[model samples]
Target: MIIFMQLRVNVTEFCIDFNCMKIPSSLLGFFNEIGAASRFVSRYFQEVVQPRYEVKQFIKQCFLIGYRSLPLIGITGFIMGLVLTMQLRPTLIAYGVVSKLPVMVSLAIVREIGPVISALIFAGKISSSMGAELGSMKVTEQIDAMEVSGTNPFKYLVVTRVLAATLMLPVLSVLSDAIGLYGSYLGVNIRDHTSLSLYFFEVFNTLKFGDVLPAIIKTFFFGFAIGIIGCYKGYNSSKGTEGVGRAANSAVVISSLMVFIIDLITVQITDVLGLN
Candidate 1:
């Protein structure tokens, strides 16, 4: 009787252990991460409105995230416009409405491609950079040191980068639109003749405040999303050299996905509001 009772107890313990081990850790971890990220974002909003703002750090971040990023965005915008125009020309020519090319290309670039593409590029460059920088600081215990020294690391680091990204992306998108139009002009002249002034006049004539405003507004959200995600990933990184790379890679992936998601939401909102 004693031996049978002991055997029963051991079997019950084994079954409990096996059941516990069968739980999906990954799904639980993902939800926990989402909750953590939400809390982090909430903290940012709270800190951002408080006194003793980090103006200098914010300006430095603006220069680094915005000014330094111009060349890449510009080149990409120019090439995108040129390629889009060249590819579209054959189709427009086939339809025998090739005269509408300028308006069509301009509308496409200004309303959608310019903002979305510039944002993705911005995410690729800035998100990974922020993640890597913060991740390195985290792994090296610099963030811990900042806290120990009575400095508000989150306010200084995350807030500045987030604000810079929020402000800079719209400006970049505007510049990209202009450069893209120029590229489109060059593309138009490659196979057929069209005056520069005429091309631009047609482009501008088709554009309106409604089209430009919504597009620009969405970019602010995009920038904010990218900046916050990068900061969040890097700030919460694990304590290891490998954590730095993981943070950077995850930041890029998540930010890019966020850009698309934001774009989709914006489009839907615009459509519902009749802005589209």
Candidate 2:
């Protein structure tokens, strides 16, 4: 009986030890992922700012990531504006603020929706693409070859992609804002006719420099966050094809979350500054 009881106690201890190991293991895994990503981004910034910049590659990536991404972003922008207007019509009409719709809608789009939505679209297209491309390069030994050749693979690949994304996202957001506003016009005209001049006048009239600048400025950070996170994930991807998918997935997830987080802080700062 004493031996049997001792055996049972040993088994119970084993089970408890097994369960306890999983919690720490899971926690460690999470922290490892965070640390790896943070280090990669820091490395990217350092490499990107160094001399001997890769201008040609940067331009090539711009065309690839930015130009190639326009079609999807434009469509999304149009739909976003049109849908927002459609959805808000009933609310505005009920409140008898239908005539105020142009300025209201424009403010909503420009001050908030335009940058955030555009960034999200950019995160989906540019970030994921950058991650997958770099991940594939990493897994296929292209990155290793560059390293073997004494070419700074991080600078060549990561910097180029991040810089392209940083520059292009602001430009893309500007275009999206314009397109979305136009969509808002169409939304307005569906119920009542308003000239472009009047629509824009009301828009500009309601908007202050404060409203415009902060929104635009935050987009730059958004772009940078997306680019760095995506490239870091891909550049450090594991030595297998599966790593490509993981990098791309992680890029989108991290960048999207970062956008919202940054946007929240931006809004708070802007509000504290009394822009609203």
Residues 1-276 of candidate 2: C-alpha lDDT, one tens digit per residue = 334445545545655778765556555455556656666766776787788888999999899978988888887888888888888989989999887877788888888999999999999988898889999998888999999998888888888888888888888888888898888888888888889899888888888888788989999999999999898888878958888999999899999999999999999999999987
Clashing residue pairs found in predicted model 2: none
- Quantify all predictions' global Cα lDDT against the true fold: 0.91, 0.85
What TM-score fits each model? 0.92, 0.89
Q: lDDT at 71 for candidate 1?
A: 96
Candidate that would win on lDDT: 1
TM value for model 1: 0.92
Question: What are the per-residue Cα lDDT tens digits for candidate 1 across 1-276?
Answer: 334445545545655677667646574456557667777887899999997899999999999999999999999999999999999999998999999999899999999999999999999999999999999999999998999998899999999999999999999999999999999999988888989999999998999998999999999999999999999989999869799999999999999999999999999999999998
